[model samples]
Target: MNALNPVFYKEKIFSAAWFRTYGLLVIGSFVLAMGYTFFMTPYKIVPGGIYGIATILHYKLGFPIGMAALCFNLPLSLWGVKVLGKQFGLKTFICFILVAFFADGVPFLLEKCGHPHPYDPFQLQDEVLLASIFGGVVIGIGVGLILKTRSSSGGTDVFTSILSKLTRKPIGMLQMIVDSSIVLCGLLVFQDWKIPFYSWLTIFLMGKVIDIVMQGYSSDKTFFIVTDKIEEIRQYILVELHRGGSIMPVRGMFNRTEKEMIMTVVSRREMVTLQRAIYKIDPQAFTTILNAQEILGLGFKRLEE
Candidate 1:
């Protein structure tokens, strides 16, 4: 939708809800980057992209990490704007600047506390595997929130998007390949393959978490129950589950006996309850539950009404 579109101009975009979402993304990105600088970088666990290079520089040359990340990402982000499109580029630029600024500020705040802990307890510990999992979760939350706002924390993701467009390969596979190369570099320089391996783990988990957040994690199922107790089945489905269904008359394919066919859609949790209700009402109910790729109606979220 255009910026001027009614939907785009909805009050929600400027409402308290929008501010909350933006605040979460900013804080989450800052905390995750702090985790890297204080714990992951001190121990030399490079994950990849601008953040990976920032960790390396922080460990080797004592460069300011937020500055390093911002500098490194600037050129790539500019390239993204030139190549990707205006909207994507602008959003990413804003997100990157915010992350860089906050990441740089976090360490100074921690030092002021005189905790001597040196690391963010809100983040993963010094352990490589835990760092990968927790760092990925934190960053994924940041990225996912930005995405919900039509923004991105510019990094290798932009490069991957460009590469996927040119190569006609799946974005996931292309990202894996590009990120794996960075991990290889870390391994080659440090001579510790475990670091690179854990970095890859972080990349994998981030992909999964971002996908779940962007698309939602709800799984749905469609059931087709063939039974003689059509009335009981309908009552259980409509009343107990509060779901709508359709019943039709049919003849058995083999026995040529008349039968009633019931079709319904439900979430995963509701599917179990429905099945149990069917079994209770009619033990011999022949039911077939199929994975529904798409459903559109009152109970489900649909692209079109």
Candidate 2:
């Protein structure tokens, strides 16, 4: 009944539509956790988040690290759902469970295959570099995929969202601040800097790669034109570019003259066609261009809405 309780605030997770969403989060988290336990953790590499903390604890306490990670994040997950919303919280829960399940299960799978266990490689000098790089890469891709689907990996993600909402700052910037601190803490306390540094590198790489995957990797250019021959330019754009355009009336700041301002979005390859058409219509037309990192829908390739 609390105003912030996710179940009370939003639709419950039991809804049929959320089943697929939860399923993907679970699979993505499992892949990430399995990759970490089998490939990276055995090398003693610390990943970002409470998982990193769990690794540190497991090394010291002699308990199951993955299990400890689940316990550590359980309270945060509950609070995150209550404060963030039920749908989001439920998704996070799915990710957490999957990650935890993988963490506990992967070692057994590796052991049954007669492969050297994850912890065994920690004793090897060569493992320090290989684990750091490979673990970072696998985790990065896994995390990226999860993020692309609009799910959180819990831990600092929940806190970062809370902070972003509270301060009205962008979530990306908040995430950078929080993750940097986590990596720094891991480096300082663990007395080993390689894993932490690699972890930071992995986080950045994952974020950029995921953004490209979800939003698209293509770039677009938007042009604003103030021209004397509005009708002529408009027709050229329509016939040649096969794109849409809009015209806005504006007054020149210095000349105090009324004019029609044209705006349109075009792919990078279409720049030459736009320029040729504009020059043909009015040689002296004032023009400005802006860069668009991602273009979607209509004539562009859009990530699923």
Cα misplacement distance, residue 209 of candidate 1 (Å)? 2.2
Best by lDDT: 1
lDDT of 2: 0.73
Residue 183 in candidate 1, Cα distance off native in Å? 0.9
lDDT of 2 by residue, 36-71 (tens): 775556656665677777777777787676788788
Give the least accurate 10-residue stretch of model 1, judged by summed lDDT.
2-11
The deviation in Å at residue 107 for candidate 2 is 3.7
Candidate 2 residues lying further than 4 Å off, grouped into runs, are: 1-19, 38-47, 81-88, 116-141, 147-150, 160-178, 279-283, 301-304
RMSD of 1: 4.6
lDDT of 1 by residue, 1-305 (tens): 54576355233766786677667657656655654665456556677777887777766787877889888789887877788776555456767887777677766777787756544544444466776777777666666667766667778888898887788889888877777777777787778868877887777777787777677665788899999899988988888788898888889989899988999889998988988898999999998988775566566777531
TM-scores of all predicted structures:
0.77, 0.74
Alpha carbon deviation, residue 252, candidate 1 (Å): 9.1
Model 1 residue 198 CA deviation in Å: 1.6
* Model 2 pairs in collision: 42-118
